[model samples]
Target: MPENPVLDPKRIPRHVAIIMDGNGRWAKQRNLPRIMGHKVGTESVKDVVKTARELNLEVLTLYAFSTENWKRPAIEVKGLMTLLKTYLKAEVQNMVENDISLRCIGEIEKLQTDVQKIVTRVIRETAPKREMKPSLTLNLALSYGSRSEIVRAARIMAEKCVSGQFDPEDYSEQLFASHLYTGGLPDPDLLIRTGGEARLSNFLLWQLSYAELYITETMWPDFKGESFIDAIRDYQSRERRFGQTSEQLQAE
Candidate 1:
């Protein structure tokens, strides 16, 4: 895909997170099964991942499934797991070839046993080597929820303090953040949500505190590379002062 000529290469976001939405709606409008929407959405995933790598993004986090998704119909849930397994099996080799490391952030153990095995294998296979640093890290949020993540981190901190391994008085935002699933990764600089959604939907609440958000009406399946570049172009046009006035930012 041709790069967007308007993008300032230096201003590209290092980390980009996406909430892939409207899959079911897309399929419904086409008179197809919801799973078909998910299936087609994988192509968009591929396109976005390729675009991010070409742009030299450090991390690309995708909200694949949420903890609440377990409440969905059993058949749909099962199909999603099967699709996830299939995607991992088919994409692991490509990921390795492209120097993209796969990482999952969520209650991975909650997935089906077979799906878990494949996920583990993909992560292991795509692990970055000392000599071959990964061009991008593809982080999938499977069976994930931000509130639960924050609670889990809090519990870990409490346990550490009880064991005398941590001092409560020394606690800081950094200390608390280190216990979260995304401990070592940089926070997303840009978050894009498809399907006209205006809500966060319990995704990366803490990490997205200061991130620029881009919402699109296009469904996930149709969000190709050009759509992604459009988001980047819009992002570049904004002023992210991070709580400072224009004068203050310009002075820096």
Candidate 2:
């Protein structure tokens, strides 16, 4: 870690989201199997977790897998699922020990029964961790889309309205947010997509309205601690005034 290796806590983003991309490309560039890229990417996860905790980031959501990813070859999917199972099984104890609570948001029921079992077990076991909050959305965009989430929320609200749950006047941004999968979690303040991508790819569509975007060329396997820190540092240097002009922001 760099000495005083931190951005100002006051200005730090309360929540950070990342789209980890380019694992397969990285593997290919090195003449290795694609699974090898994913394996190496796992190493980057440890570094990012530690850094996020140190930075006092309240929430960190990672786009681990997408609904669209299922379109890939069956063997690749199995490999990814296997890696997920092994990683979750191996990380449960570490997550609890680190006080990093494990949370998931997605149509996890679609996962194989065995994988679901391990996931449920890990969540329960790490439920007591408080060191840091992590909400990992695996198999996201699979049966999960921002539009779908928003529509679901609206439907819930409509049902409530019909049932006389409350006045429709109560349906503000805050109220609508309550119906979201990330309802209790703070909205991501910063969103980064590695591998030089700038698109959202359907991750956290509603939560990143005002987020600062960071795009990097580093592949997921190569995106280690230092790379993450560099992005944060870059973020710290930015001027986020929401919608205000510089003069108005300065006056505030």
| Candidate 2 lDDT tens digits, 87-173 | 888877777666677777766777788988987888788775354435432222223557767888999999999999988888799
- Report the C-alpha lDDT of model 1 over 108-211, residue by residue, as the tens digit: 99988998899999999999997566899999999999999999999999999999997989899999999999998899999999999899999999999999
Report the poorest 10 consecutive residues by lDDT, candidate 2.
135-144
Model 1 lDDT, residue 86, Cα: 82
- Ten-residue stretch with the least lDDT total in model 1: 1-10
| Cα displacement (Å) at residue 196, model 2 | 0.8
Give the best candidate by TM-score: 1
Return the lDDT, model 1, position 40.
Answer: 97
Q: Return the top candidate by lDDT.
A: 1
Residue 96 lDDT, candidate 2, scale 0-100: 68
Model 1, residue 249: C-alpha shift (Å)? 0.9
lDDT of 2 at 188: 82
* Residue-level error in angstroms, candidate 1, position 108: 0.6
